[model samples]
Target: MEFYGKGNLWNFVEEERRNMHFTRSLSFSTDQNVSEPHESPFVSPKASSASATSIPLSPMSPETPWKLSPMHASPSPSLLYHCLASLHRYEGNVFSIAISRDFIFTGSESSRIHTWKRPDCTEVGHIKASSPDVRAILAHGRILFTTHGDCKIRVWDVSVTEKFRPKKITTLPHRNPFFLFPKKNSHQHKDYISCLAYNDGEKLLYTGSWDKSVKVWNIFEKRCVDSFVAHEGHINAIVINQQDGCVFTCSSDGAVKIWRRVYGESSHILTMTLKFQLSPVNTLALSSSPSSCFLYSGSSDGLINFWDKEKTSGRFNHCGFLQGHHFAVLCLATIRELILSGSEDATIRVWRREEGHCFHSCLAVMDGHHGPVRCLAASLEIEGLLVYSASLDRTFKVWRVKLLTPEKAAMEELVVTNDQQTEIEECKMSPVLSPSWVEKKIQANHFQ
Candidate 1:
């Protein structure tokens, strides 16, 4: 037993060393080895227990005492990303993710949604909706909404957490209406519920499904209020702009449509139909800067279409494109002016908004997940960002990211800037960098 504080220097050092050893063990036991400074961004499929590279980004400064290493060795002009934690438990691909004030929810192909504590990846509870895949999740006041491949929308009352069990309040369609009314059957969605959105003020929930239909439900009533075949292909995602009373829906049919509620009419009007998109729109995000609000749509291809409100036309017009990801942009997350996109190429790209323009520059590429990234959630912190990424590889990782904090960034900019430095240059010069010679240079640059 030992005390910890200013006076207990030896005890603190011993505790820190144990923590370092524990973290290293977790990293190595999680089915991969530590990555070298050069061979980063992607963990090779051939990684073994014997191989290693665990370098934390926070240089052992007096202010901080922990381990972290940048996931991308290639300099991002002025940014760096570090892995904070990695959680692996699901048996299949992780499809969707949601972050609440107190919990983190992840839906997967294993037919369950796993719940963890907000600050750390501590297992708290889980709900097995059915034998089919849970494709999406939404957190409201006290209820958790989940869309499943079994073509159903399940409402979970999470307030009743007696034994980590959330009660399934009701399923849509309320059993079958055939007994009540033959024509109005109990069939809610014929295919799958792909996405969900909610409007707090209106007290309604919107769902998009693979049946090429969008359905509106009164959460309090647990009944489908309206249903319409709104797309030609399977609906991919839905997002609500409550301030403008706009419902944006994306589909595999390669189009995004906007709907608005009429004052007295029971049905919503199709206000706009965005066309000319050659690829199927897969996800949608609303980004707000100090000056304006913009809508971003991720596609089956690697392009993310940017649309801004046209003051003159009073409609959303195509502003430009944020083109970075090489494969399909599966998910998108926005925090203030920053945009994060996860793609089918098994990497996440961070982009910083240019303040006044619709275009954005790629800041860093995080390559740790071995499968296509399926979902991402980001929350702003006082100094940086806490980002969570879910992958089809059956694991979700938490990352800590900040831009331009190291004194060595300016000098290291010219040393290693891209992938070319990893293979040809490092192999050619590695033979000359001896242990003593490297140690001398590292000590001389202590400020880094």
Candidate 2:
């Protein structure tokens, strides 16, 4: 895409694309000779041998068949796989992750920002701003917008390189600042920004805050286009469905608000109101469809609720609730029919949407980090389905769903066998085995 304007913003996007191209070429050259293995785990000789029967067929049997039928082994486990490409370590928990065409940006509790490559997860740049805690990162074309605890939104140009790093081009601070969710009698509160999103096609940036408000800004003109008080409680997430020209926002008050920009006589009018309610909505995600729309929102009560825009009267009914993670769902991403969610329970769950009323089924449960998962992002480039998740463990992980190679399957099988043998050896050495050992000794003496 051709980025307009003549300054640092244009230069930065160009430089990032150049660097990405160079890295892509280098990776291709290095990975050309590495071929993936291709052995089928289902058709193993041991499995086939085990299927054979030891007893002869009975004459009274219907067919008098002695041999077992050729058994077709069960289909291999869906071939889903994940690999850690690079780890971005932070001082505190990472709250959100965003990716553009080239770079992956992460916001952390340390009030710092980090950028990395898409598939490789190579660190590209870093920035430390006055806002000590960053809550959201939104990237549109060439600019990266961040919302922080200082009750201000900062805009940075991500294309220009200064001292081998991208420099901040401009910063936009919030005009009216207040506590995120102020109590009835509390006056010393500042509204904390909970989420940020951008509609590049419309040149508009949106932010949701704990003050139960959603604000929109025009980046090209550098002014607030419109602002609306959206929810009764803290707004948790905001997502722009550019295809339908509808902006969706969810809040802790358990409601999802939809805003549409209506072209007025002179300027534009942001017609905003509550679209539906998915109580205690913590995360929001839109499907890839352009006409009939669907939204997936996760709640604080460990429920993933689905809402179909074309079916109900602007009301989100819980079509299906995925039950697995025990804590609050923090972030969610949808790519076609696949949905990936991260939660405070320190687990990442992948779900596939089926055709029936039961929309999604758990496909994989990734549990390695010892801390709560805070954010998730899905990448469709380089890897088919890549998931980047940030957690309270102070590390960001990259996971991709790919078919397992034969060599990997072999290695896993060997590891399983070794573990089984070790378990058997431990059982033999256990104190509880003394009685069995005496019985075995007596039987051996009698046989001899």
TM-score of model number 2: 0.66
lDDT of 1: 0.68
What lDDT is reached at residue 311 by model 1? 57
**Each candidate's root-mean-square deviation in Å?**
15.6, 19.7
For model 2, residues 1-448, the per-residue Cα lDDT tens digits are: 1111223222432333233322223433464344424312112223222211122211322321111101101122333444455353523457778887778888876555766766676565466575556888887766778777767777776663443255565555433237566334222125878888878677777878888777777777666667667778788898888775678888777777677777551133444444343447789998756445567887766778776664446444446567766556778998877788887556677787765344666766665444557789887765557878876555677766643355654443332333333432453233221233234333534654
Candidate 1 residue spans exceeding 4 A from truth? 1-77, 160-165, 176-187, 289-291, 405-448
**Per-residue lDDT tens digits of candidate 1, residues 20-132?**
32223454456432232221111222232222222333333343322122333444346655577776642456778887777777887655567766676565656655544
Reference-based TM-score of each model:
0.73, 0.66
Best by TM-score: 1
Question: In model 1, what are the clashing residue pairs, if there are any?
Answer: 34-53, 56-68, 56-69, 57-68, 57-69
